[model samples]
Target: MSFSPTGQAQVLVWAPEAEQVELILNEGNTSVPLKKEEFGYWSVTTDLVSPGDAYKFRLNDDQEFPDPVSLFQPNGVHGASQAYDETSFNWEDDNWQCPLLEDFVLYELHTGTFTPEGTFAGIEQKLDHLLELGVTAIEIMPVAQFPGDRNWGYDGVFPFAVQDSYGGPEGLQRMVSACHQKGMAVVLDIVYNHLGPEGNYLGAYGPYFTNKYNTPWGPAINFDDAWCDGVRRYFSENLLMWFRDFHVDAVRLDAVHAIKDFSPVHILREMKQQVNQLMETTGRTHYMIVELDLNDTCFINPLEEQGYGMDAQWVDEFHHALRVTMTGDQTGYYSDFTGISDLGKAYKDAYVYDGQFSPHRQKSFGVKAEGNPGKQFIVFTQNHDQVGNRMLGERLTELVSYEMQKLAAGAVILSPFLPMLWMGEEYAEPNRFQYFVSHTDPELAEAVRQGRKAEFGMFHAQGEAPDPMAEETFLQSKLQWDLLPLEPHQTLFRYYQTLLKLRKELPALKHLDRQNLEVVENDAHKTLQLRRWHDEEQVLCLMNFSNAPQTVALPLNAKTWNLVLDSAAPEWKGPQPSAPTANAGTEVLMQPESLLVFRGQS
Candidate 1:
């Protein structure tokens, strides 16, 4: 909806199924009939509705519902939609240039749990903390308006409206502007797979869903079926709205595998083309990162190469292999990973299961991402799913020792791939990041509780899963910022800061070229030696996942390897006081469950 200078607004609705459409303004105090146009669209130029006016659409004299393209749901999902002027907010980030994808050190966070306030403004208050941690980008979880204030955001029913509880549209603009001023990029997570069950009135408008494919949630979106053109336009406009109106640097599409689109011109490819056009038109940098379960390179590959042209993708294989090697937990997907050797493959070839027969799926999975650069893959030890989906939502800090936690940090940060840190992972916060929701429907809430129980059947969790509908569950998942200045947590925070600093200062680590990388895994000793070079600057990352000290022979070279950072050093509160350097043909003693970084020049 766009308002004219004379307070007249132009309203448009796409309701192919409705015989009559009425614009109900201010709780039906004023109503204006819409004229039907071709292609199942209804439009009207009305003076009754203006900016900030609460409105709803009445279909064929039926029950009134919030706008399908509502910009603001002030009273929640089941309430009236408020008119919001996207051009009203004064942006202060005219000169903000987003960092290159290769340089992005992402910090994934949930808006409601990152702070006590649980709003976008609350996030703005912590910009200095993130800056001190050396995070280049902040990937916020879904902020689309869900049923209630406590959801993890996957249950969002209004795709266009910003969460009213999270300070609404203006609040997000403030957060983005603040981040840009601090030289940080923002990546917003979006869901195009399925909308939340409650308050979902799209079915009354048109065939927005189809039975062609079934997603884990429910019926897939109608992206390739009849009347898919309108459905496609709705989402494509949403993709551009983030960059154009909200000033978001990028969007992390949640579960692209679940988006069932079989069109000849794939929806993903169309999105990429539109993004490119927007970037060209606005002269601003933008990217589209996808969360993909399938380890397919077609999504990240270039358009010229018959690919979806996505900027990057999250690689769960790296996290799976790393977790298996460190924790030795062979439960669901971890059974497919073989330990440090698979992690070695992840370091060399982004995908560990490249056309290999999987015991999990009982079939060959994943194709080789051979020529793809290391920057194309995003690697992390813990994410929202890896942590929150657990029955108890145990973070790495809860399951592993202090040394192992540091080792995990080193494993991700010291690798060539883009590194992302989950909220509170830096300080090793003890609170569990469990799943929670606040659905109004009692039956729906009960269904969620039972669903969580069924989902955890694969893993042998000792006790019953926490009640996802409980308010305490959401409160318990929040990050404890007070722990930052406390013991062990502060040390770990410094350790991560130092590692990020080294990554920026060292050429061998800063350059993300994987072609010059060589990874050697010793399965018997449970160790990995990674050697990568940029020009004359060479670096070696030695990891020991075993529980016993191992004396590993160093490769004979012309240059001496000097100790850079050691997880087992006394400074990091480890068993060892310091790390030993290795010369040509010499040996170094690696502490149990520790990682060491060394720099050398020839």
Candidate 2:
């Protein structure tokens, strides 16, 4: 089962349906016969295939196709898989260690549109910028191979291979190396819930999928059925490969709620246990974070609590509450969150629907996370799904005023939880993060377009759905790198950088325990305030969601209070207030669509 380290060729192909299978090298220039086993898996071994050598699978009657689990396909999705030498690349991050979860200032970006070049190498050049902006980690959207060169990466079929268009496997390794050198950890967003519609050859190979459960995409993966042990191992091995081979520090599991596993030990727990063992063996503190819409804390709880034991989980409640409070848009899911009370609850409890009614789901769900530390929750104002799934891909910057945008930023960064920022959110880039996919099948493409449009019909009735297949939509989604150098963008970027710096430097803000946090709400005035105090250091944060200025007395007593940050400063083009009055002890004025942070002297 093991090949020599000097670059030998060994392949394991599970093709029970195929009558015959052979290795076709370089478009049928040569062929190597494979040995079939009782389990219906074919095995091949030869020194003929070396790194960069193109090859394919030849089934019965010379029907040749790419390897189902190809490690590298330099030529493209339809091309032959090249022999990939994972150990050839010289890595210089032997001493690199990732920052702790509490120290993470995460920046989420899509690889296909994060820069002008939209390649792995292109992103390497911007690592210094992120490092300078105080980002401790970069969470890249899925890089697994999809149907075409351009995609958002979520519709990936080849979970083990990097996208050939985005510089392939070698390009990705280089990007990770460069990031480690800059003291920034890399978190890869991986989709295990479902594979893309096109090039999904796993079903042809084995029972990689099942009809026992249905996901939004289609039939769910067979993680608990017969031969499902190997299926789960496939994904677990993929996670290990990323951390050991590519030096990725963490993995962000996309849409975990869709992973319907009925096994005694769930796939999430198995993956977590394997990752923990890997971390121990490698002496690296890697993380496994999940994106779940379930609003459940079990994923982030300890294994002793009969939970999945994830390091952190994304809290959609935080984003939903902030979105409704800032924009006041009550269509779709926003209908469940209309008042400032929801925002206040999200700020204090980190889950607005803690066993409460959810009009969108037509069910009462979620459990209260009272004693859990805030570091276990990853809070964001905007993320890929929140923006890209919209009809026009309008980000928070497009709907909320500049002051509210800053307030949103402060609300997340200064809170007791870890914060994540979507790409271009710091500078309020005007570009939209629209959904894009590249499907080879004509019928599949048309179906996708129709389904997308139909889904948005209830929310937005006008205009045709932006073609997910169009090259222009993909190009338009790329980050406008030039905007960072412009006026207002530059100013806002500086503000975000300052906020990150403050979060790192200030002891009061760095405290992430939920027990140390307290919140007060004035729904009538559309105002919410959160007070985080620990060890004699106190921070009072106030946010005004109304369209007009309002004044509210501070809920805490302090001898001296200094104005720290104001979202309504002239820099953000909002009303500026005079210097904070001295000895304001229990009274402070708040501006419309603004956020204020005050540090109190004990």
Candidate 3:
């Protein structure tokens, strides 16, 4: 059961069906035979099997295969595992501290498409860009090794290893150091629910997965089954390893709803407690954010109240309402969102479908999330799943006008909730982030490609689905870093920068007090107005979802209200006017597909 010092040289395999197993070293020079044990695990050891050494496993006389638990892949997912030294890289972020969860402006980025190089070093070069954008934290998509070099990282099988294409563990450390040096926190996305189909060998080692519960991604993890205690510890230890070894500030648990556990203490609660204890021991405020489909606020609720402890969760309701209003596409999940009324509810209550009958799910879904701090919810107009899951992976920019896009950005950033911006959303990168995977087995690869096409066929009818395996799909997804210097892209980037500054500088906008939010909706006209007041400081947000300008009556009592920010304004470099006037109790004209923010003055 011993692993190498560098976490490489697995040196063991257990295949009862196979007669023999051999460790295939680099260049096909030599083969090291593994001895079968009584417990059914083949074993071997060699000093030559150091980190950065390319090697794989050969079953009987079959072709060599990459190690299932490989720590680093120097040549990509299809290549043999190479030895990697995690301690050799020099880090200069000793004085860096992670910002509190309440203050986080997370910018989620897919490392594979974040830059032309699409490596950790490539992202490192853009740390200053994020810092200047006023992002308090950068949420990187999973770094764990998946089947191939190109992936969204959700299908990662080796949870402990960094993807070889991304510079392995050392590259990750370098990225973290660069982020910390720029006064920004790094949150790594981790998947514990299920491993990718290819290169998965955890079941061979032990019961890492179980059939106790069903998951969309196949077998559920064996968290509550027999011999599962060590399995639980394995994941917890992995979390600690990331924070301690790679200096990651936080972890965004991907699709945690799929993790089934009925133990006396739930695994999530235990993990949260462990992270808190680690925070105390290391004098660092490490956080865990979960992505759960359940609308339950228990995750963010205090642990003392019999709730699972989590810093925050993604509010899909907000994204849904915003998307429906902007795009007018009521297909699939968007079917539940109809008009500005739903959008207003989302703005005020964080969940538009709470306990309401959903036409899409064909059932009453979502729980009321009242009295919860808005900061407990992470709201985004578009994220990886929402965009990538689409038929063509079309961005919001493709469906809406530039004015509407800016308005959507304004609504998300200025809202009370913790705002998250996806990679390329700032500059509206024209490329789409389509579903991509690299599978070693040809049959599995074809199955994946066909599965994706069939899945999207339910919603879209006409065009041929893009080949997920095609090199062009991956190439198209890469962020055009040069676009940021262009006209509208620069303007959009500045708009994001301005919104973040306003969120930080304006007292009323910074208020996360959900109790203070008020919403007024005009369903017929497809417009909504949201007002927030913190003591004497007050701000009003008006958004028109329709394609035509509409006049709305103001109900607030104010001698004068100054126009602060307008999505359609020339300052935003959009077609709409620079300013709009409004009088108390008077009907004010709001530009179509615009968001206007006004502040009450004495």
Top-lDDT candidate index? 1
**Candidate 1 C-alpha lDDT tens digits along 430-537:** 999999999999999999989998977765548888999999999999999998998998999999999999888999899999998889999999999998889988
Provide the lowest-lDDT 10-residue window in model 2: 578-587
lDDT, each prediction: 0.92, 0.84, 0.82
What would the TM-scores of all predictions be? 0.98, 0.96, 0.90
List residue ranges in candidate 1 displaced over 4 A.
Answer: 4-7, 457-461
Per residue, candidate 2 scores C-alpha lDDT tens digits across 191-291 of: 99999888777776678898899998999988998778668877888888899889999999998999989889999998888888988898998998999
- Clash pairs, model 1 backbone: none
Which TM-score value belongs to model 3? Answer: 0.90
Models sorted by TM-score, best on top: 1, 2, 3
Better of 1 and 3 by TM-score: 1
Off by over 4 Å in 3: 1-70, 75-88, 458-460, 576-583
